[model samples]
Target: MDFSFLPKYWAYFNYGVMVTIMISVCVVFFGTIIGILVALAKRSNIKILEWLVSLYVWIFRGTPMVVQIMIAFTWMQFSGLPTISFGVLDIDLTRVVPGIIIISLNSGAYISEIVRAGIEAVPKGQMEAAYSLGIKPINTMRYVILPQAIKNILPALGNEFITIIKDSSLLQTIGVMELWNGAQSVATATYIPVEPLLFAAFYYLMVTSAMSGLLKLLEGRMSNGGKA
Candidate 1:
């Protein structure tokens, strides 16, 4: 097929790439925070807290992300967003709120398990040793356990970052002009479906491949007797 369509919409493609990257960064940042909280909650001594976190993880991880996005979009459209009467500083939360919330909640569910596993991988003696020195649990986790857990989980987090890039395309369904959405728009406008899609696929390949290489390098660094 002719990829002649690429040049015509190069600007649009660039915008799509930026939007994709922007949304993915937001998702990863918020998702990681939510995941850490969920992971800690799951291990909490309170039965109610653990049960609530478990339910959240179950619902988010069990359902399809597309469905969640669709539902979130529908809900936002009906409810609209909060309005501020500030002069030139009013925030429009409607457009982005649904997408960010849905994607982060979904990603957080998966990341929670990854984080839980990483933390668990550390030996129990580490905590015992910290406690033996009269260390507070929070300080013990922050200074000792979490540092090791982060090292172990860095590769998985990188993988999740790559996954978020691809998955952000789902936001296109809600009329977000992300990479796939740009391609779909191009295909419809140009009447050349395959090539525009292929062009978008090329960008996705480049992004994911680059992230994979970076993850491998990080893994090597972390594995070399913790040198890096």
Candidate 2:
């Protein structure tokens, strides 16, 4: 097989790789924030808030992400409403923005439970002691709870990051032109399917493997200090 095409198409592949990374990073950032809020809501004292969060998590986590993406894209098309708009400034949001939002919202559902489990894994005694010390609930959570919870959550969160990195490939269905899309484009253009696609697979493996290694190092460091 001629391997020379790689150098010739390096720029396209690189651009696609960057787009893939951007989508994964955006998903991780926004997904984590949304997950935290949902987890908090799930743990809320208010019954209605807890129910609402539970429903949100149930729907997203129960459904397939591809279906959600299809629904989102179709809704955007049918609504003919921009995913984001500044009415005063009259600026339109790009397709990538909505794509990121859709992916993050879907990912956030699963992350919520991960976060909730992490938060709950903290000892009850710590919270009781904080309360006995006259610490406000919010302050107690901010200072004592979340910091301890994070150690428990970090490994799972890292796994989620890796999952998002692979799942971002699904965005190609919406014309995102990410790594998978690049491989497909090259395959169609050159009439050679296997090589380019294999290359894309190799790239994905490289990225996720590196991430797993980093996460292992972090886990070791955190564990060295004792269990959270």
- Which model scores highest in TM-score? 1
Q: Cα deviation of 188 in candidate 1 (Å)?
A: 0.6
| Clash list (residue pairs), candidate 2 | none
Model 1 scores worst on lDDT over the 10 consecutive residues at 83-92
TM-score per model over all chains: 0.91, 0.89
What TM-score, to 2 decimals, does candidate 1 have? 0.91
Model 2 C-alpha lDDT versus the unseen true structure: 0.84
Please report, in order, the local distance difference test score of every candidate based on alpha carbons. Answer: 0.87, 0.84
lDDT score for candidate 1 against the true structure:
0.87
Query: Distance from true position, residue 49, model 1, in Å?
Result: 0.4
